[model samples]
Target: MRRLVGVLVAVGLALGVVSAGPASAAIDSSGSAVILPPDQDPFYVPPADYGSRPNGTVLRSREITALAYVMPIPVHAYQVLYKSVDGHGAPVAEAATVLVPYTSWTGPGTRPLVSYQIADDSLSTRCQPSYTLRVGIGSPTGVGSYEVSMSYQALLRGYAIVYADYEGPHSQFAAGPQAAHGVLDGMRAVLHHAPAGLDPNTKITLWGYSGGGLATTWAAEQQGSYAPELNVVGAAAGGVPAELGAMLRHNNGNLGAGLALLGVIGLARAYPESGVYGILNDRGRALFATNEDACTLDVAVLHPFDRIENYTTIADPIDSPQARFLIDTNNPGQATPRMPYYNYEALQDEFVPAALADGLLKDYCADGGTVKKVRIPFSGHITGEVQGGPGALQFLADRVAGKPVTSDC
Candidate 1:
């Protein structure tokens, strides 16, 4: 969210990098992309009982109703990172919107909603990633980032797109409710600034796959309460790695063990009670020094999971007391949602455990939450990107049409 540090974002836009022809207009003035204060535009507040929030905004329910409106889009897109509280009132980072108009129009701007896309580690520029290589990792087609596809989908539906690096630049894998705060705050920046080429009424539909699924679930659980102004219609989380605890135990000695490492790092971040941070002595600290900064989730997947084998075990990183607490927090998908939610799981997934998926489904059904459970037959975790995404779109469209949603889902 900070001014994308001029880290020379080593990755250059490749040949086929396409920004869908501008279907919108631009801002009427010059701008710093200046420094802004946190909570200048309050959205989040604590407690189920109503209370006036950050900007003296009154909350009727848990949801923060009216969104700050921004119009007259800016010529160039600009990004800023600031801190704000999540639905649970925890301080977090937010990435502001940068509107780049692709069209010319003078008529009163239509307020379009934004669909958010959570990418993997490709978000950081400090080390300069190979865009081509990163795109390939996200999509084997070697064609484009998912946002390219997601943007087209949003535009077709008459909504703008907002790509979120919910993991922040550091890529916190699954911190749960804390992640979405930034995503929603960014939506606020878009609404308040209404950068020249962007829409003023950009509502939101949180969407993601695999690693991105964490953001979708986080944002959905926070909506109707955190940033009610975003008017989040719904959310779709594909390849839901619902339970991190199961993922580690099940993935032991398997191809998916790498995810366990990512979970350790993330959970340790969100729940300090997990005891991962202090367990490691100077030796354990050294492993993180070399590994944490350079390692991506994918690269870590190639490991030995035997009790004392390799990085997979995260062997003896924390004390027994702290280790138990961290392991206990492994279940993430159990969130009691405040909005419509759908999650897809690959029955044969080597990345996310099936038991976790099944357990989450049972909890969701029992909680009386809105859900669509799609079990991918004979598929791994990524199939949902191709299959579940369209289903989610249909679900969102139905909600927008004010049509009844079937409980059969």
Candidate 2:
């Protein structure tokens, strides 16, 4: 109880989210606290349980970003954040996706709210996450869309799950500060668009896995200055690389296999200032040609083991002093973090560097921000969301309930 109160006060001071109405017990539609019980399946719904459709007001799983095109198959009805217009009187593309599992509601309505969650990658249209079995795995196989799985889950829960492709159209790289803007905007788009039937002032929460974790961290941190009007009760994130610079540096040398190469190549493709092109050898250049524009997951599978092993020090011939400067600033420790973070990291992560995680956590702790770490005994480098998702959900659930997160596993 004390921890929960501390979270409210700390979050209010940190994000400046003023509570408007009386606070009540917060929770998702699901009655389960954190892990779903043995009888309940966390991901899928059985055919026998597909009963009558929800009369609740919700635009589930549909892509309403007003960007290029609205993706088909509304994931299901989730609690949306808000919506607004841009400077030119255009609709601001702000939104996030959410999934609510609830029991009998004593609240205002039966229909769940529209909501959103950010995708876990840098801004890129690359098809790495696509898969034959999964829609968002980054491979070109399968249905090649994430909404299908999201919709499948939402329907079973009788709630909506919003999928915020927060990378924006340009797929910006390492723009951590701008993360809050994208998240808030994406979430707002849903709230404003779907409030006719659902509650306009319904409770909202944010949760994410990996790259999405970074966005969640930034959104919570910058809630004070960005979209103060939105009633964002709590946000939960897992596997936070709190400091981007430290991440870059730690991964630069032979820390991990495909990760550093892919991350560096991706960042270089996004931000040229890191001198990425100059550091690559002929073999590295060939590899870059194949994957400079590829998605993170695609690089993980396609590149044979031999090609990934070549990822060594950023500067092979370290005698030259110029390369040293490039190496120094890329570490996560050197980069300054800009927001309050619900940070989590894996202890034996093959993708994320241990040194980077340690340094970033130290800094965030010093800043008096809320830090939640879920140390995975297994390596979650590949399927980060699958591994860290349950914990992420519970963390956000606590925050929305106005509780401090004590589940630091």
Q: RMSD for each model, in Å, please?
A: 10.5, 16.3
The CA lDDT of each predicted structure is 0.49, 0.43
Q: What is the TM-score of candidate 2?
A: 0.58
Which 10 successive residues of model 2 have the least lDDT summed? 128-137
Per residue, candidate 2 scores C-alpha lDDT tens digits across 41-112 of 122122232223221112233322111112223333332323322212223222244433334334333434
- How many clashes (backbone atoms < 3 Å, residues ≥3 apart in a chain or on different chains) does model 2 have? 62
Estimate candidate 2's RMSD in Å.
16.3
Per-residue lDDT over 268-363 for candidate 1, one digit per residue giving the tens place of the 0 to 100 score: 655666556666556445554544532332224233353212432345433355656655443454366656777777777767765675676677
Q: What is the lDDT of residue 195 in candidate 2?
A: 34
Q: Model 2 scores what on Cα lDDT? A: 0.43
Indicate the TM-score of model 1.
0.67
Q: How many pairs collide in each candidate, listed in order?
A: 19, 62
